[model samples]
Target: MFTSQGPSLRELAVQALSSVERGYDLLAPKFDGTPFRTPDRMLDAVEEALAQEEGSFGSGLDLCCGTGAGLGMLRRLCRDRVTGVDVSAGMLAEAARAHPEGVDLVRADALALPERLWNTYDLAVSFGAFGHFLPAERPALFGGVHRALRPGGVFAFPVGAPIPVTSPLWWAVAGFDTAMRVRNAVWRPPFVMYYRTFPFGPVRTDLERAGFTVETLPLPPFGLREDGSPRWRLLLARKPAAQYG
Candidate 1:
């Protein structure tokens, strides 16, 4: 699923063996050519949904903003400044090159943002990076996002419906996770990407524990499954506008 301009199999193999940060650094330059980059259609769909729901936002943040794929969506939705944060300096550099102006790129771990960033943003969005976080890390990740957003601000991301057990995609993901487990057992600096870990039920619970009121809206453009459920839904988590003593 990669173009000739994308990383070669040997490059991808090397990346899979490296630490997440270093792997992304090696992958950053050729990222936009790979399937790993967030699809433009998905970005457009999310931007449309946010524009319709919130009209516009003051400032925006993109979490784990690898190569700043979601920066364009933030630019369309935010009237003020937009910021992108990632742990890989190389990815941030590539993002800066691509976006050039009207966006700020920060190299930082998303789970532990700087205190200066607390309550500073009106909206936040993330795309395609959640798989890199293990399930146990969700609470801290969501908590950091909650603390980064201003009161009444939104943190939104799209989640796909679970693959059916009968589907080939299910077996493919299961095999991949199993392979990752075996690889981590034998390898140093585990890559930490898994397809099946972030189900909606557990994710909603973590978001609630992090002090967000959560709801969802189906992205109609992706259409429905044979079972008539949405193929994808946007998770909208809102921090409360007021605090009670």
Candidate 2:
């Protein structure tokens, strides 16, 4: 769902046909007006969870940081500096406009970060960006986050409980994913956004392989589901202390 200020149908059609970077560039200006931006309530819960898990960080990084929505959370959790990296220059420009003072916006692909960034951050985060990545790319993306963090540093994000397969919401998401697959089959530069692609089990495995010790904490503020399971959980993963020079 989108607000009145969100992208028009023509604008959405344009974005859908472009490459992911260009699509996001076209979408950046009105991004916050869409449900695509992580909600403040979820952001607050993530901040609280980070505070409890890691206490505080010296410097923070936001991977695929779209329009710097998560920068405020990074600023609250980190003491020194907060950097936002994105592949879309348009998105980075918007981020610069929105977070002029406290944040640094870098235009770079998360899969191909600069060596100078390695081990430069104490905390790394991403919000509402994973769907853009294919499942096979998770290892590289997580590895980049690991590379960006200092030893004992963290990479955190909030993940929601899976929609029930019996529910209409499930059918809706499934149909959306199916349509995306069909579109990709017939299109160039596929827009890779799938809801069910990044399940927690495989994600934890990828994080572990990328050298992170992972844990999940319930976000109670978002409340529970019918079975008393949390509607969402915050993933807290730490890069292990360096073993050798």
Candidate 3:
């Protein structure tokens, strides 16, 4: 599912064996050519949904903004400043080259956001980066996002509906996760990317614990499954405007 401009099989193998940060660093230059890059249609759907929900925002933040694909969406939605934070310097470099003006790129782990970022953004969005975080890391990850936003600010991302057990896609994801587990068990500096770890129910619970009031909006462009369930929903986790002591 990669273009001719994408990384070669041997290059991908080398990346898979490296740590998450380093692997992404190696992959950053060609990241946009790969299927791993968030699709423009998905970003468009989210931008439309967010505009309908909250007409316009002030400043915005993009968590784990690899190659800054989501920054354009933020720029469209936010009136003031737009920031993209990532752990990989190489990714940030590519992002910088693409978006040289009207965007701030920060190199920092998503789980441990700097205090300067706390309460600074009116909106925050992440695209296709959650798999790198383990289930146990959700609390910290969500908590950091909570702290990063102002009161009534939002943290939103698209989440796909669970694949049916009978589907080939489900089996493929399951196999990938199994292989990742096996690799992590034996490899040094494990690359913690698993497709199955971020379920909607558990993730909503974590967001709630992180002081967000959570809700979802169906993205109609992606359509629904055979069972009449939305194929994708945008998770809107809002920090409350007021909280009692």
Candidate 4:
């Protein structure tokens, strides 16, 4: 419905009625053509932000990496292995088709990531998938990511400015979340997606509780809101490197 190449209205309705994993499986082929795909401008901005960090890394991981939108950037930053993990098999297949080489695409849940992920990865990133996770699930999600990384590995993602109540977009976002909640209430296999669930304050606290030292950097490419606050911020969650006596 978004464009000629994007999924049709009926396709989107079918996806919305199915579980999140099944929905993405149906949408995988045309996912990139849809607005759901993270924009290259945002990805490039993130890559630029990561570059300013400590020089080249040994490996990188794209947590919940969807169609692998961030994989190419991870490939550019990490000197060695680059991997993409997602719960959706169809999404991984699309990622594999897109990346073709220099990436290990694994199918796994972000909330219950495998033990094999321990102490691995110098960097990890995710984009536009936060809405899939509910606020109550943050602990498991963050804790799993905490365990997935090696000492000193960084996890980064962007946070857009909170929509002001006066803005039309605020109502639109609120309405969408309301609709999703209603849909989930009656549906058997709930399609979990909500816009307002990932507030930064709770999220930062969750990350810190999960063992990350968290901070934020403004992404200037997206510019500032009228209030002078940044329109977007890059959240960095760093795991402390191992120390010994």
Q: Could you estimate the TM-score for every candidate?
A: 0.98, 0.96, 0.98, 0.97
Q: lDDT for each of the candidates?
A: 0.93, 0.89, 0.95, 0.90
Q: Number of backbone collisions per candidate, in order?
A: 0, 0, 0, 0
**Which runs of model 3 end up more than 4 angstroms from their true locations?**
243-245
Local lDDT at 91 for model 2:
90
For residues 1-245, what per-residue lDDT tens digits would candidate 3 score against the true structure? Answer: 99998999999999999999999999999999999999999999999999998899999999999999999999999999899999999999999998999999999999999998988999999999999999999999999998899998999999999998999999999999999999999999999999999999999999999899999999999999999999999999999999421
Q: Candidate 1 residues 86-142, lDDT tens each? A: 999889999999899999888889889988778889999999899899988999899
What range of 10 consecutive residues in model 3 has the weakest lDDT sum?
A: 236-245
Clashing pairs in 4: none
Candidate 2 Cα misplacement greater than 4 A, ranges: 243-245
- In model 3, the clashing pairs are none
lDDT string for model 4 (1-245, tens) is 26688899899999999999999999998899898899999999988888986567888989889898999999999999898999889999999999999999989889988888777888989999999999899999988888878888888999998989999999999999999999999987999999999999999999999889999999989999899999999999999887210
Model 3 Cα shift for residue 165 (angstroms): 0.6
Residue-level error in angstroms, candidate 1, position 66:
0.2
Q: Worst ten-residue run, lDDT, model 2?
A: 236-245
Q: Local error of candidate 1 at 244, Å? A: 9.6
Q: Assess candidate 2 and give its lDDT.
A: 0.89
Query: Candidate 1: misplaced stretches above 4 Å?
Result: none
